[model samples]
Target: MWQGLLAFVALAAMAGCGEQNGPEAQMAQGQAPNVKIAQPLAQDVTEWDEYTGRIEAVSSVDVRARVSGYLEKVNFKAGEKVKKGDLLFLIDPKPFKAQLNYAEAELERARAKHELAKNDLERAKRLFRAKAISEEEHDARSKGLREAVAAVQSAEANVYTARLNLDYTKVRAPIDGRIGRELITEGNLVNGGGADATRLTFIVSTDPVYVYVDADERSVLKYRRLGQHIGAGQTPVRLAVADEDDFPHQGTLDYISPREDTATGTVTLRGVFPNTDDLLSPGFFARMRVRGSTPYPAILLPDRAIATDQAQRFVWVVNQDNQVEYRPVTLGAHIGQSRVIKEGVKPEEWVVIEGLQKLRPGIKVNPERLSLAAPY
Candidate 1:
């Protein structure tokens, strides 16, 4: 019985030894492991710097009255498009009209007085030449005529002012834009003129909207070095609204601040985009990006192939000998699922894209070559 048990144990040991020599066990004993490898894709690419920005109207105005009076009529609908010089509101024109009439009547009275003074002066001049009247009396008459002439000139000025005020009673649009709702409704007295004038509504131009963003000084300098001129419309930009996942709006850089904000160390930049469809509105939050660098040749690799070790980024490279090598790299902007390799990797070198867990430095690999035309 003991000899039979010993034979069984011996057979079990022999079976275990035979299993160790199979395919799986051979891999652990220095047989090459299979991995996917591909050379980096080389192409001309541009880098874009992203920023949070705000959409604004190219032209904005706070509508107000130039003459003070009770609002008589609101001529425009709330949030409607208006043309320049379009009648927007009507003040109490009755009072202004009456004032204008009185001024005209006064002007006529002054003209009559002026005519009488002219006749008097002519007679006084004749009397002085003939010595029929004393010189002092003639001089007094001449001075009286001069005073009348001054009064007439003053009355003419009053008439001009009255006509100007009458025209102001009919409020008109100052520019072409969309108007807001009336804040001072009909029958409400609105103060006009001076600093305390009441605000009736607001208007903002609809087409060709503006977007403002603040960029760091370093970035601004870089853009200047790249030959992006302010207001030249050469530099291109892109924008996306809050709900959008990708930038769909295209615009051009139209303005850059002449001075920087010392406190924040950032300069303001403005981009202009056409809003003929009225999709963009002032005060909307948006994400914008500016072309940071011109197109240049660069090497790119799949983002998944790169691994982070503490603070450093690295990747596994498969050389011509089919041996894995660890390499550190400098990275640039991310394009889709691929990363731009700024340094450390060459265009012709093959990088491991899969089976990274089975890789170690100096270990042989059975690499399956793949094309990097499309990212994986």
Candidate 2:
């Protein structure tokens, strides 16, 4: 009787197992995988080129002393905006005054000599008429008068030189700009060799700033071949700065190099920026974009959707069976916060953007269609 009961229990267990996976499971076997697979969607993707750049002053002037003298007073504060011909520094005038006095005295002495020579010439002519003096003596007097007149002219030139030297004591700004730090203090003598002398201060024009960006030979050729010539003929260059969220200033392409740099394999293109508020300074790094090129329609994927494999970049594609498959992709230039997808998955296909780590091929899954919770 016990053996019969055991056989019956075994039969019931087998029947229960059969019913668990009934006809419903067999019907869903092919369609279950395709029921809901999450994959990244790729739409239209555009192309763009980017370049890095830095801000600089177009006219950077270093204020130097023209004449050697003690720096008596600093008329303007450091970092102050100054106009053209503004007084920047003052030198001690005592020594220049003495030199001018000497020149004046010499001039006065020459004038006295000239007057004496004039009287002597007149007397010599009178004596020659009366035959009271020899011809040689009259000629000697005439020669003396000529020498005296030449001396007067020499003295006049010396006076003018002395006046110019005195004027040099007062130093003025060569260009209208914002001045930098003071190199020499009051009572310190600065040499005035001009080019060879150390700069007393720096003066850079802040109204308009210049920016230079590197464009490689390939890029230049590419643009030229496309007939874009985006760097030529007053083409507008857009600027992107690190400090600003949006493009704050608009610049135009002012210069494009003819040749490429052998060391860097790039050519320098220059742009002029209007820094009216003095916000842009030299050495600030920024990005440059060439305008006038037609933007292509492109598929943009958010930064989160892409993943990297060893030596290959791919995205997880959920198949009809709810299995994740790795799809290799090629990415193009950046578009705002997203990247332009050049190759890989198609649009509207569910890409495993989330829950990718827990997936394998042919794994049955309970697919929950994820919705975009926040707008990017």
Candidate 3:
């Protein structure tokens, strides 16, 4: 009887030791892991799409000499602001002036001859009426008068042409903008007023600048369906330069190419921006963003709450029982710190924003409820 009682006590002691070493012992002693969670935020949001592009001038002009002559003077310094009709270059005007003088002398001579012929024709008419001159002689005087008048008209046209040529010697700015370096310097002979005219310099309008970008076919279709017409100048856009962290420049969509580029599968778009302070320039590499979609209510969660599982994206959703489960989600856009959840998550449901790494699907968590406004 004593041996049997001792054996039973020993067996109970070993069993107790085995129970302490088992997984149940850890379960009784260990605490649930702490995690922070918040409900998804639902708000009205507009999606923005980004693009890379280049800056272009709204108006650009290649200054070319309009008349051939030796360049005598450059009126404005290179890289300076100039207004319309401002003199930019002066060709040698001596030849044009000489031609003008000759034309004026010829005009005077023709006028004198015309007056003499008119007087002669009048006298002949009177003589013919008085039967003092023959019909043939009177006809000859009339013809001479007409010839003199034709000569006078031709001389007048020559004078006008000469004056126009003289004016062309003084090259003026065609637009108000900044000018580039002089390509043709003083004393250089420049060919002008022809297909192969010499380019003196170039200018670009600086006030209202243009930014050119290309968008894919899908984006174009999306914009069209959303009624966000980029060509109508209603869509708003923002841009930043390479060194800029934020988009400081604002503009409106002004133009869209009529046809898409077949090879590139993109449509060219232009945005107009007011560069009042001359902060923007042409040929600058820029990052542009335009409103991709209209404002609509969306479910949003902090980006930190999102987790990736191989090919899938998910979030740790806390159920009513304080348990976490992997919830697959479809994302839309990331605005600020919140990402748009297109599907798979409801606004009323809480998601684990903190302690995501310690979470597993269907695991119980000690969730300390936190607001989305809390910093990580």
Query: In candidate 2, how many Å is residue 369 off?
Result: 8.6
Query: Mind sharing the TM-score for model 2?
Result: 0.66
Q: What TM-score, to 2 decimals, does candidate 1 have?
A: 0.84
> What's the lDDT of the predicted structure labeled candidate 3?
0.88
Off by over 4 Å in 3: 1-36, 134-136, 225-231, 366-376
Which residue segments of model 2 deviate by more than 4 Å?
Answer: 1-48, 104-157, 194-198, 223-233, 240-242, 289-292, 306-331, 341-376
lDDT of 1 at 173: 89
| Model 1: residues with Cα > 4 Å off, grouped in runs | 1-26, 29-36, 228-233, 320-323, 354-358, 362-370, 373-376
lDDT of 3 by residue, 91-145 (tens): 9999999999999999999999999999999999999999999999999999999
Task: Report the lDDT tens digits of candidate 1 across residue range 201-231.
Answer: 9999988999999999998888776654433
Error of 1 at 108 (Å): 0.9
> RMSD in angstroms, all models?
4.3, 7.0, 5.6
Worst 10 residues of 3 by lDDT: 22-31
Question: How high is each candidate's TM-score?
Answer: 0.84, 0.66, 0.84
Over the stretch 171-227, how does candidate 2's per-residue lDDT look in tens digits? 888777788989888889788755776468889888788889888787667555444
The clash number for model 2 is: 13
Ranking by TM-score: 1, 3, 2
